[model samples]
Target: MSSFEIYGGKKLKGELTVQGAKNEALQVLCAPLLTAEKVTISNIPDIVDVNKLIDLLQTMGVKIEKVERGTYVFQAKEIDLSYLETEDFKKRAGSLRGSIMIVGPLLARFGKGFIPKPGGDKIGRRRLDTHFDGFALLGAKFNYDAGEHFYSIEAKKLKGTYIHLDEASVTGTANIIMAAVLAEGTTTFYNAACEPYIQQLCKMLNSMGAKISGISSNLLTIEGVKELGGCYHRILPDMIEIGSFIGLAAMTQSEITIKDVSWENLGVIPNTFKRLGIKLERRGDDIFVPAQDSYEIDTFIDGSILTIYDAPWPGFTPDLLSIILVVATQAKGSVLIHQKMFESRLFFTDKLIDMGAQIILCDPHRATVIGLGRQHKLRGIQMTSPDIRAGVSLLIAALSAEGKSVIHNIEQIDRGYQDIDIRLRNIGADIRRIN
Candidate 1:
């Protein structure tokens, strides 16, 4: 139970190189299980969730060697399937949301996969039906144990078929694609998630001899291969972290440069910030956000209030809505944040209201923020982090507020952002981690 003690009302100015994408790392770390040859990966973020997945893979007998910081080589030769029956395996796999992905590769190569109920941020109801349902459509038999809260799937051989997903779930689409790559026939996935993470996964699989098309579209076609080989893959910079930094700069009036952001993959993130009247420049592959005393929120063309909502990729990401809400607190106008995917994510706004931000929690799914235009500075107060995104959002608010603030449960932030307090300290922020 560590906490962050922050001295607020100071600007942070420095260069931050974004880490590798956390979501992509989770999906692609399981790719090694699809082959026995060595698969090398670089630019891996040193975070809790990713490390947990690596430990789980090592426990399952995947030979993993660290080439250097943020680089690793994994070979899934002679994986121990019997480990899946152990109590240790259950505890490990059940605690990680990313563990659900390994089931697909196991089923594709070994004809069976077993897992306990996976766990992650308690944001809302994230159903596993999409993952298992996609597997069932690919000729796998699915079973659920209500008493033990476990799931198991097995198949003699998978034959590819058409799958129209109920939702364009990112992880569900990644799991299904991993399984379909080794199936017997052509697999057509309709309404699949086409985020950069998914696109990278498909590109990685294609490099490994899997036939996949429609890299950046909802319709994906895959021709099953006999087997996959190994390849070296580099992950993209985390867009969520980049967006968070942009918000941090606007709220605290800091000039910060984020390096090598992979601009093309950012989608609508930059324009979304610009819509809030925050000024940022594109210097090559880097994003430079200038210091600002105040920013204004944009309204719709017909003179309606600006309403920002989350949708599938190419739209605003739900992960950054928390940052947007906090940034709006200091802006010159009002905006509505609609968190459509998760019902409980906006609940953290209560903490912001305590810090003197004018926010109306209209419901579980929406919040309306009226910017103070720096008319009154937010006063720091004690708070606790609810989840990863919300935790960072609170940290941003505390940094821009007046006086001292203590934030407990900083472990939530560490799960996603690596060495966050240390990074802030390097950028002239008065943040200290207390154990």
Candidate 2:
């Protein structure tokens, strides 16, 4: 395992360009499986999770060509369906959470899909019921092997129908849309996830001859097509990374410019930072976060404490709540972070408490942070990264803390952020990766 040895209390400068959306890449990379024609995807992030998915595609015999650093052409012309039955496929697919998405396209084109229990961050119970339930609603017969911990679904032909999702799950909605695109009738999907990533997937499917409406709304209507063709698609910049940079700037008193952030797609992210009294400005499509000694947390209008919680899209993203919670630790006031979607995500706050932050882990789902206002600097210590988001959060904290910090299990951070230590180093951060 590798670790990051960070020399803290350093200011970062220079501009950083955000990478392509990791979540969108996972969804669109699977879209190529629905067609035999060439599907070109641009601005793909060179991150571990995305690369794993690409490797999985290559193993399935998808013709993949690297057009450039962040562009690739994929043609699923001669897929090795029999490979799915191999032990190698099980080990590979079971380790990746994004592998669950490929099942939809396989079922849509080949009438059958099989996946082992998918693995991802142990943040909380991320149930697969939504994905399989949506598949079952589309006329697929679902089966499970409890002893083997495997899931399989098959269907002669899928017929579209109304689906009111139990929750607005992003991946679940993407999977169902992929399945319904080639179904016999129109699928009216209500309470769907309308995040930018989802909208991008729908738009990409539409470009491929699938009829889809409601681009940015909860109600989506997809008319099943006989077959889908290929098209060119460019992914949006990762909002999570952009948000992380913003928090890093505030915590470390760094002036950083994030370039080409796709401003319009960053719903409520900028305003949420502003709510924390962090000064940032929009320069064209870029975000400029100025260096600050201390930022103040905003309270509710009725004089109550500021409570930031996660909800469906257009609200604050749960992914960034870890960053927000970490940023709040050094702010001028107190704020409550409510991680509603995941129960165990806030558990990482214990590490921050060790770093000298005043934090109250109210429960598994909530944390209250009383900012120190820079009166006392956080002293770095040895820590372990729990998940992708939390790893980055702890990295940001270490960068703003005093003395040396060793962060173990940096592989978790690499899963989401590409060359994070290198990027931070380029911006004048004293971070080194030790193998």
Candidate 3:
């Protein structure tokens, strides 16, 4: 258990480059398991989740070697799907949400797969029901035992069929697509998740000889192929990290530039930021954030405050809402923050309140933030991080606060962002990581 001791209230001013997306890198790393040939990946972030995923892949007999700092050569030429039965695999499988991603590729290649209950943040009850439902519709029979939390899937010859997902679950859609890609017939996925991660997965699958159309749309049609081969693909830049940097610059009142931001891939992030009064300067492909004292929140004409809620793709991401909530404390007007995907995400607001943020916890899913609008300077205090996004939210709060603050459970923050303290420190952030 390491913690962060931050002496805040300093403007972090410097140019920082965003790393590769964690969400995209996680799935792409698993894509290598679909083929026996070597696959090269660049721009992979050096983070805890990525490390854990690499470890899991190694357990399944995939050979991974680092070519450079943020690049790697992965060859899944010798895969032992039976490694899923080991205690080490079971432990790692239960701790990472991305472990479930292996089920689809394994089932497609070996005609069977076994996985334990996957884990990540304790935000809410993210049911595997949709994942199982999608697999069932793809001609797989599943058995779940609660005491072991083990899931087993078996299919002799997968036949593609029309599947309308219960909801637009990202991982579920991906699992179904992976299984459907190797089936005998055509598979149509309606109301599928079209997030950048899913799109990247689709691109990787297509490169491997899987016939997939509608890369950016919700409806995906996959023509089953007999096999796939290794192909080179680069992971996308992290949009959540990009959004986090925007929140960081706004909170610190610092001028910063986000380099190499793929503006074309960012669907609704610009509009979402505009609603919170953050403007961007698009110079070619890069984004520049100018220094600002405060921003005004958008409100309705009826004189009632509106809430910014999270939804599926083409909507604001639920992951970045925590950062937005923390940034809103320094904005000009009040707004409601709604996290529809998770139940416990709003609980972290208690720490912000102790640091002098004016927030009303409406319920498990919503909170009303009446911004002091840069008029009140929050004083530093000791706190513990709860999850990944909330941990980053607390870090942002600490950076904006006055005096010194001690943040325990910094490992939570480290899980997603690599060398965050080191990176921020380069930009004049006074943060020290201590164990």
Candidate 4:
């Protein structure tokens, strides 16, 4: 097991570039299978999840070559169907949730796909109903094996139709879109997720000769094409990382600049930080956060305590709620954090409480953070990272604390954030990764 040993109470100052979007890379990496030509993708983060997916693809005989640091060329001219039934495939593909997305392209191109119950963070119940239902709507026969915790979807041919998602699920939207691009008829998806990742996926598909409209809106219409060709796509900046750095600067009283943060795509992330009274300046395509002595939380106009919650697109994402909740611990006013999407995401507040922060856990979904406003410094302690978002939040708290803090199971952090400790160290954070 690896751990991060962080020494706190020092202000950080420097500039750092945000890595490519991890979630988007997960979907885009699976996109090349729609065609027989080579697809080159740039700005892909070398994280555990991405690597796991690449390994799973390699096992299926999908020829992939890393052209450079963050660039890869994928050619799916031939895929080995026999790999799907192997014990190695079962062990490797089942380790990451993104592996499920492969089924969409596999079923689209080969008409047969099987996915084991994929796993990632144990945050909540992430159901695959939307994905399977969309495939069934496209004429795929779907079945589940309870004993093996597996799903089987097969179709001789796919015929697209109207699919209104019960919720705006990102992966589900990407999967269905991949499946429908090569189907027989036009597919109209209402209530689709319009996150930048989804938009990029649609745009990439369009570049590959697929017809898709309503790029930025929740309603998407895709015209089926005969085949998809090779395309080049560069993933966008990690907005979650940008938000994490914003919280890190504020909580550590650091003056940090985040480079090339595609402002057009970060709809509500910046303003959400502004609501917490954290000062940030937009520098061209970058974000400049100055060292803050203290910041005050903004309450509602009716004098209610400030509340931050997650919602669909153009809304505050649940991914950064843990960061915001941790930063709120040192702010001037109290705020309520409502994690509506995942029931167990807010449970990480208990770790912050152990670090001398004032937080009241209302329930599994809600937590009220009473800011200490740097009046009392947090004392460092040993902790384990529960999930990706919560792991970074704990790391930020450790940086703002008084002594040494040790965070174990940093693999969760590595799964999302690439080289987190190294990047933080370059920015003057006293952190080291122990193998």
Q: What are the per-residue Cα lDDT tens digits for candidate 1 across 204-264?
A: 9999999999989999999999999999999999999999999999999999999999999
lDDT by candidate, in order shown: 0.96, 0.95, 0.89, 0.93
Candidate 3 global CA lDDT score: 0.89
Residue 372 error, candidate 1, Å: 0.8
Among these predictions, the greatest lDDT belongs to 1
Q: Distance (Å) between predicted and true CA of 267, model 1?
A: 0.4
3 or 4, which is superior by lDDT?
4
lDDT of 3 by residue, 58-93 (tens): 878999999999899999888886677888888998
lDDT of 4 at 267: 93
**In model 4, how large is the Cα lDDT of residue 213?**
97
TM-scores of the models, in the given order? 0.99, 0.99, 0.98, 0.99
- lDDT for 259 in candidate 1 is 95
Per-residue CA lDDT of model 2 for 123-146, tens digit only, reads 999999999999889999999999
The list of candidate 4 runs beyond 4 A from truth reads: none
lDDT of 4 by residue, 1-435 (tens): 999999998999999899999999999999998888999999999899999998888888889999999999999999988889788888998999999999999999899898899999989989999999999999999999999998889999999899999999999999999999999989999999999999999999999999999999999898898899998999999999999999999999999999999999999999999999999999999999999898999989999998899999989888999999999999999999999999889888888999999999999899999999899999999999999999999999999999999999999999999989999999899999997
User: What would the TM-score be for candidate 2 when compared with the true structure?
Assistant: 0.99
Total residue pair clashes for candidate 3: 0
Per-prediction backbone clash count: 0, 0, 0, 0
Distance (Å) between predicted and true CA of 365, model 2?
Answer: 0.1
